[model samples]
Target chain A: MEQPEVAVAAGDTSDPLTGLRAVSSLRVLVESYELRQVEAALRAGMSWQEIADALGVTRQAVHKKYARRIDPTIAVPRRNRT
Target chain B: MSRLTDAVVLSQQIVVTATEEAYRVGHAELELDDLLVALTAVGGPAGDVLRSLGVTVDRARSAVAQVHADRLARAGVPAPPAQPRTLPRTGGGLPWSPRADRVLTAGQWDLRLVDDRRILRDLVREPSGFVAEVLAVLGLDAEGVLTALDAWVPTATAPSGALFSPDPRPWRTVTRRGWVPAAPAEVWSLVTDPARRTAWDPWYSAVEERADGVLAATLVGEAEGAKPVPPGFERQEVVPVAREEGRLVEWELRRPDRPGGAPVQRLAVALTPSGGGTRVDLTVRWLGVGGWRAVVGLLLRPVARLAWGQMLLAKHAGIARALR
Candidate 1:
């Protein structure tokens, strides 16, 4: 069977359709990668604030998103804590 | 109720019990060992078979623990003393391991629902893995269990269409909803247009509309993290069942080569305008299958659901990124 021609070339953001599709795929990849990193950081005893800083997000935002998913006891105390 | 419906209800109970067992053990995912313990607890022909073979809930639980300890010892890690802890259940049930998912769906399709006996048979049939390890810890082997199961029979006849009736619903539906950061029109176009599919949809490498208004597509391989098309089912014929321009689109995914075969999947997408974005509701319905192939297909249902959910999430993110 002949290969069908793609409407737009790979990584070609000139077309709105292709551009939007690329964004979605990239987002999925980013989210999966982020999850792995967060899990590793938690296992390494990183604090929520530290992980939030690494991701350039607010501590509350990161904590709210992941605190429930991971074991609470595994996370270390915030760096500011005594 | 029909035997299939009875099996379905029992299977669900087994899954719930298995999830609780996994949670109690501090395991993040439901494994085959947990299912074995669950089967013993959920009384039925499978439980009866196991009980007759001296496999009780308590015995299975201890065997599972011993297997875990043995594995840890083999890895040169000291096994922690058993500690009982009560943890709050997570919102959704624990995710099932791929192997466990396969075992749960290993029943013969002719039997309809994956009955308990089939699950037990599959568990014992495992040559290695958690189930096998646990069985070995219990001083039992696959052949011994298989022999026992073959010889076992129900003491009472299963109640037939007397009081309860077979469930009318045949297909299992999985629905996922996401907010895409794009206008309803844009999201609709992305979903309905075959030309733009490969861009956002990871499942297809190429999709072209046929003259008959059906879709013929080349599926991407599993390397791309997309669900693999079953062997000899490489060719797909997607016929649109219903559509509302810029709102909803429904299609029946079938295999053109398998003439007269029931549609394998039904997909429906509804796009609703929600504050500055589009709310995308994707529904995937798996049609029933019979014979041995159904085992493979049914087993992959959980994996397929996860894959579809992830794909939708990615598509939503991409649309948002592009629009932003």
Candidate 2:
């Protein structure tokens, strides 16, 4: 890959434009990583409560966000839980 | 019966795959790099060409990450962790970026069919330069890729008429069953005899047995309220491949003017005695073309199946009328 002609100093967060772009990129990266790990956990037959405990969040919060996204066949059942 | 051609089906698959690629990386809008990555996954001539040149999905995904990392590096921010290999199933649509839309619709200006290969060409010639940059990162160039694609010949070598066999895997089969007010032997005689078929079958205007034991028929194209003959097809030659006396008859239909190795449509009519009448089952297996069309067929299968169902309904009605 061809390198850009000019490179900013390492760990320099001085520039506002660069800082904002980096923030946006990092947010997208984190969201994608979270979705992937959640999918892997579901496929591995882990229940929602287990995943929530690992992420330090409530089971209901985790299930509400990812239940629709995950395939129903692979999703671990939530017995008698709202 | 439907106007959805193989090109249209293939294009739809490409766009859907590209959308998934965008969604996999948390992109709100689909871009050229997403399309390039998708081309590696959708099985078609373009995908085959890319794979032949060593552009596998894993390689393309890594190269795409490298491009994103390089862009972020210019901003003094370190690259994030690599994306996961398994893509998430996106529920809704992602709007296409302007550059991506432009590359997709560029083929409409030309008279050429907008197949995957055409889309690949348009991607190479896109003025936005994003796809070209990705190609550069992949150790390839537009000119080299195009040359390789142009020279690439598909390896489908199934012999002419060999696709007409009893194997129902590749072909799309449409079946309709109805009770005709006649005995099984009587219905079988009428269906097996070409002269009787012309009187009852709405699809055939005239049918005659040739010296080679095949039946040559003039197709009824949009006449007498019959279903229109598929475009580019004028005549149908039926070569009987299987027969059980007074029980079943299977004929493989081929277009006389079509090129050799083109898909042959198979028509099988099975008769059985039921409730003092003949239960006739009509099956039409169509477009058994083995290469890229098969891939496209898998994508738009429901559309083709529905169209075939409509035609079969009309034909079965005609058969019942004649039997009465």
Query: Using DockQ as the measure, which candidate wins?
Result: 2
List TM-scores of chain B, every candidate: 0.46, 0.49
Instruction: For residues B215-319, write the lDDT of model 2, one tens digit per residue.
Output: 998887554334567765777788998887777788988887886856768888877665445556678896556688888978888998878765665565556
lDDT of 2: 0.67
Candidate 1: tens digits of C-alpha lDDT, residues B1-324:
356655655666577667766655655567777788877765556776777778777788888777655553333334354453343312236677777888876654656434577788888776444576677887888778778777876564221111111225686766555444356888877878888766655456789998999889777655443457787577777788777777777888887777767546777777776534565666677666788868887888778766765555444433432332
Cα DockQ of the candidate 2 complex: 0.11
Model 1 chain B poorest 10 in a row by lDDT: B157-166
**Maximum-lDDT candidate:** 2
**What TM-score does prediction 2 earn?**
0.44
Off by over 4 Å in 2: A1-82, B1-4, B85-91, B109-111, B154-304, B307-324
lDDT of 2 by residue, A1-82 (tens): 2234334443456776555545545555566667668878988878899999999999999877666544333536653212
- True contacts recovered per prediction: 0.00, 0.20
Clashes of each: 2, 0
Docking class of 2: incorrect
- TM-score of candidate 1 against the unseen true structure: 0.41
lDDT of 1 by residue, A1-82 (tens): 1123222233454665434434533333345356557867988877788999999999999876665444433434552211
